[model samples]
Target chain A: MIIRKIRGLFNHSVALVASLIMFIPVYLVVVNSLKTKVEASSMGAGLPTTLNWQNFAVVIERGKLLTAFGNSVLYAVGATLIGTTLAALAAYVLSRNRSRFNRFIYFFIIMGIAMPTNFVTLMKVMQLTHLINTQIGIILLYSATSIPFSVFLIYAFVGTLPRELDEAAIIDGCSPIRLFFSVIYPLLTPVLITAGVLNLLGIWNEFLLPLYYLNRSAYWPMTLAVYNFFGQFESDWSLVSADILLTILPVIIVYLFAQRFILSGMTAGSVKG
Target chain B: MKARTYPFYFAGGALALYLIFFVIPSIMGIFYAFTDWNSYSTEVNFIGLNNFRTIFSSGAGQNYLHFIRNTIIFTITTIFLKTAIALGLALLLTGGIKRLSYFHRVVMYLPAVLPILVVSLVFKSILNPATGLLNTFLRNIGLDFLAQRWLVDIHLALPSVIAVDTWRGVGYIMVILIAGLMAIPDEYYEAASIDGASGLDSFWHITIPLLMPVLTVTTVLNLLYGLKVFDIVFVLTNGGPGRATDTVYTAIFDEFSKGRYGMATTLSTLLFFIMIILGYFVIRLMHRETEG
Candidate 1:
């Protein structure tokens, strides 16, 4: 009994230690971001002697975080709404129809899960369309790239609903569009939130696409802003840390409030698909 | 409002966006791969297999073979470490530690939620050779011999990149495994205990077999992501210390930057084919499992 008690305690401590190890990087960023320039250069993980909120102000000014933050919100929201709406509409069709054509299209979208976006060629295509280095371009690109997964996710969820709902709505003198908007779409809230949150997180955090497309600082997203900021402020650890914190702040907040939905939604897609 | 016709209308918007941006670009990518395309060239000429030959041959300091080797090393090592550690952590979290498990899960998962760029930048500073926190912590604890130039040393750079990738990734995998572990019924363990089976015995006999499906999913997910990994390598090393950490994706990016558009497309085309083969197997496996 004593040995068992000791073993349990040992395991718990081991977990605690492991958790602390996993957290040290975050802890370093958070703590150092609040320190003065001198204190930050010391590179110690200790708390600041005084709470210096000036770091945030400096990063906000230098990094142009406000503009970048706005761009991120616009891109993420625009892309998510467009992708999700299109995907939901398509998913409704794919789920309801059992035709060979519909099946083939559904399978084709599923193949995109394995397909990595070829940004090398994508850049050339973007140039040809004159969409390179533009917010509209990034939004359109994100929406397009995100369609496959969004369609697949919504298709999976839509499959779970009974065909009776569609039948009942159709018999009640409803057009297909009206039937979708009034009855079927309401039933898809859970999966919509799932797909929306997942895509929002993905588009918001995406670095490569925006990095390649948006060369202008004015149109840079949050991730790109942080990257460019780091290049200019590499010597100033405190400022860079502040920039990092600010960049992730919105995402962290969203994740905190929607933790349950995001976690379950992420795993649900993987498991079910 | 014919039901059948409505379906076509519904799919039109998504199909338009997908075809123009995704499908067409993919096709264009391959076609361009066979031509001497570059930013400087007004009209691309057919180059046949020359771009591929450049990669295959030892000319122009291409280091193509090295990139492939490094990619395999990075993908395999990181996947192995990430899966093993995630499984270990999942087992521990599920091993009757009830009250604080939620807190632990949230804390561990916190990193995975942060942007990969942020994670890479944070680690870039943290692993700095001079006055970085990691080395400072090591020295403070009298482990001075263990410290080395982490991201810059040719010998240490690739492994350092892999370690950072595993650090950021293992938490997400652990959450997946935990979800898998939780799905497992407790009755099996209870019965095993009643029959005088040890903890290890029950874990091996019951848990391993039952968890195979989830494990396969996790493994394939890791492998797929690993094969196409770019963000972390780009942000951390930029495939640097003289291309020591270069993967195929980074190689493509570099060639594109240097106006070697045809070469870049060749690399991209090869990667696409590899992905298609992998996708074929994944679809087959999933279909088999679902059917059975």
Candidate 2:
């Protein structure tokens, strides 16, 4: 019993140390964002002697911070809406109606998860389609990338739902579209939210695709805004940290509210996807 | 359910977008790989195997094999470190330290939620050679010898990038693992203890075997993510200090930036083939698991 108690103490200490290590970066970002440039570059996680809003002020003014935020929201929400709706609709059909063609299509779509985005070819395709730097073009591309995984999630969820719901709706003289929009779609709310949030997180945080596709400053997403601003302010640690903090705040807020949904959604994606 | 054309309608929008954006480009990538397409060229002429040959012969100051080697090394190291640490964290959080598990979990997952670029940018400053927090902390503790030019040192640069990747990745893996650990019933552990099994003994005999499916999934996901790493490495080191940290994806990015479109497609085609092989096995494994 004594040995067990001692071992328990040892385990807790190790966990505490690990937790602190995990938090140091976050603490550095938050604290240093509020610090003076000298304090920030001094490379300590110390609290600011005085509250400093100048760094954030400078970042916001120079980085066009709000526009970037709007762009992130526009892209993430647009992609999620289109991707989730289309994926869910397909998943419903695939769930209710099974055919070799459907199965093949499902397999084909899910394969995108494993394939790296062929940007070299994608760039050419985008250029040819006149989607090189347009927000709508990026949204369409994001939706394309998101479909495979979202379809997988909704498909798995729809499998657990009984077929009788569709049968009942159809027997009530409901057209297929109305049956889907009224009965089946409402029933899929839980999984839809899951898929939506997951795709939102992914689309919002995605950097490489945006960096490749969106070359113009006017169309830069939040992630791109942060990257470019960081380059411009290479030596200004305070402003850089402040820009980063601003970029993550919205995500952090969303996470605090919907962590359970987000966590389970991600796990479900990996495990079953 | 009877056969209906409705299913096709439901899937058409997504299918069209994917075909236009993803599939056609992927197929074209193969054809383009054999062409001499570049920003400087007015006409894309067929140059069978030229790009591949040039890459093999090290035309871009970065040999194809060097990128592959660096990619494999980085992937394997990050996957190993992330999986092991995440497992450790899950074990620690689930075993006897249950009270603060929520706090620990939230804090651990905080970094995972941050954009990869944000995380990388913050760490670029944190790991700065001279006045960075890491070195400053080291010196303050009288361990100045430990400080090195993290992103600039050839030997240490790759490992530093790997560590950062592991930091961003481990928490997400740990959350999956904790859920997996939670699913195994308490009776198993209780039964093991009642049978005079030690903690380590139970962990080896009971915990590991039960966690195999989850572990397999985690490993495969890690392998895929590690194999395709780009954003973090790009933001952090930009494959710098003389190609010390260059991976296959970054090499492709550089080629694309340099207007060597055909060369970029060749590298991408190579990566695509590798992924296809990996993905085929992954699908097979999933099918087997589900069936059994």
Predict model 1's lDDT versus the native: 0.85
User: Compared with the true structure, what per-residue lDDT tens digits does model 2 show for residues B109-202?
Assistant: 8778878888888788889898788998898999989998999899999999999999899999999888888888899999999999998999
- How far is A43's C-alpha from truth in model 2 (Å)? 4.1
Chain A TM-scores of each predicted structure, in the order given, are: 0.95, 0.96
Each model's C-alpha lDDT? Answer: 0.85, 0.85
lDDT tens digits by residue: candidate 1, B1-292: 4455355789888888888787777788889889998889798999898888887886767889788788889989988999899999999999857669878888888888889999998888888999878898899899999888999999999999999999998988988888888888889999999999998998899988988887887877887888899999999999999989999999988988998888888888888888878877776665454334
DockQ of each: 0.61, 0.64
